[model samples]
Target: MMSYQQLLDQRAQLEADIAAARAAERRAAIAQIRRLMSEHHIASHEILPRRAARRARLLEGEVLYQDPVSGATWAGRGRPPRWLAGRERELYRVNLESQDSREGR
Candidate 1:
């Protein structure tokens, strides 16, 4: 029969061995994944698609109209806002030249 101290020491050793084994396995798995990715010519973006790319495309157009009261902007892609309702949309059309100059274009 092992003493209490001896059993505790054995448990500690077993835990250390388990941790080492886990680390080795993780390293091997990472290496295997890198090798497979290289062989298949897989890009990181292909695996993890960018939501930012889609959002950027959606917001590609410049601001076409703005509300003078609230300073709200719209790209004129979707339905007109309430501020522009029953109003001439051309009245709120953004001046491209002034906008470009403000942006240091």
Candidate 2:
């Protein structure tokens, strides 16, 4: 029974009412959250969880083992080199001379 313009106006008014209601709801929620935070003595930082970042790979430190003949080096980290599998670890121990040379000695 309403005119087209009246129907359009009603729809616009309804949309505005919905928007206002949503705004009020959001305000209420924020007020409730603030109250809860104050009641529990919760800080903003405490509300959010701390992120644990992956540790970065460090610089390779001093070498622990080496092959004198081939000059291959290992820092004694991770898996041992294939050539060192059956050999005595002391036999492949990195000498002070090699370390010093690497350090510009």
Candidate 3:
């Protein structure tokens, strides 16, 4: 029995209510986490594992080799891609100009 405009307004109001509820829930969850951290005297750094720190450092640097056919690139740091097996890495070496161009030089 509601008019079209009334139904639209109701929908908008419901959306706003849902957003407010979600924000309140997030704030409550964050407060609970803070309380738990304080109770255990846990530092923020202690909450983060050491593997993440290592990964953050390792992700830097540039691609050293590439597969010309598949366009797959490797930074030449960790294990070489299987496609590179039995092939000369020098043949797949990426030039500085190509690397710079790809990075929006």
Candidate 4:
């Protein structure tokens, strides 16, 4: 039996209460996370692994092409290097057979 205006006011107050509760809970969570990080001596990098580190690990010793003249290597990812530009990429491909033989494969 509440009036329309009374119900609208109640709704507004409920929304404000919800927002305040969310803010309080977020602050508490952040505080707990900080405490745990401090106690464990955890660095931010350890928690959030770097994409560059993973990329380097994956590309390690994985040269797909080589510039015979300069001996520069590429893993055939991203943009082609200056020496490899405007040329057939297959010409610069590393000799996989030679490489496999050298590795005793």
Candidate 5:
């Protein structure tokens, strides 16, 4: 038998608690990430592959590419036009040796 004002206040308090909990969780995660980086001898600002921004993303049959500056995920569905530059070919081969070794051909 809560009044309307009491219900609104309860909702507001719950929302604030959720936000505080989220912030605390974020801090904990970042601390763990920092500890792992130190243990692995990785730089603090090391960049990893970006994640997709869509609601339900999958990589099984999707093409992989990154926007160097903004790290936006994009597909490579269509054939490249003749005007595409040749130098871009080398940009996609950053970890060439790992890829070749994986095939073990």
Candidate 6:
């Protein structure tokens, strides 16, 4: 039988392994999707919302779909709006720092 400490250690190891596997899966999925897009000539940016991220850090953040062939980010101008990239995170910080809204953006 495993001791309590040993069991805890095993649990931690399993959790870590699971997390690593999930990251690998995400990377693989990204690659496969890119290949499919290329094969099909799909043109569009991926607008992913940071749902799992901290509400403060998520400020309107989105992963602009990048061109797989050219390695340039989407949004036609060689990338999405710079400020829009992490607007959500900024908003979260502002909301945290400003107790009362006296200043307006």
Per-prediction TM-score: 0.46, 0.45, 0.49, 0.48, 0.44, 0.44
Q: How far is candidate 4 from the true structure (C-alpha RMSD, Å)?
A: 12.8
| Per-residue lDDT of candidate 5, residues 3-100 (tens digit) | 99999999999999999999999999999988988899997335443343221233332324544555543344466433333548445323435634
- After superposition, the stretches of candidate 6 with alpha carbons farther than 4 Å from their true spots are 45-105
Worst 10 residues of 3 by lDDT: 53-62
RMSD of each: 10.2, 15.3, 7.3, 12.8, 11.9, 17.1
Q: Which ten residues in a row are the worst by lDDT in model 5?
A: 53-62
Report lDDT per candidate.
Answer: 0.87, 0.80, 0.87, 0.88, 0.59, 0.56
Candidate 5 accuracy as lDDT: 0.59
lDDT of 4 by residue, 1-105 (tens): 999999999999999999999999999999999999999998878876788665765466667899999999988888999999999999999987797688775
Q: Candidate 3, residues 1-105: lDDT per residue as tens digits?
A: 999999999999999999999999999999999999999999888987788765654486667788999999888887889999899999999896776787885
Q: By lDDT, is 3 or 6 better?
A: 3
Q: 1-105 in candidate 2: lDDT tens per residue? A: 999999999999999999999999999999999999999999986865444211111133567788888888887778999889988999889786766787884
Shift of residue 102 alpha carbon in model 1, Å: 24
- Best-to-worst ranking by lDDT: 4, 3, 1, 2, 5, 6
The sequence of per-residue lDDT tens digits that candidate 1 reaches over residues 1-105 is 999999999999999999999999999999998899999999777865678665664487678899999999888888988889899989999998897788775
Tens-place lDDT digits, model 6, residues 1-105: 999999999999999999999999999999998898888887544333355343433343422344434444332234444544654433323332342333331
On lDDT, the candidate that comes out on top is 4
What are the runs in model 2 whose C-alpha is more than 4 Å off? 52-105
Worst 10 residues of 4 by lDDT: 53-62
Clashing pairs in 4: none
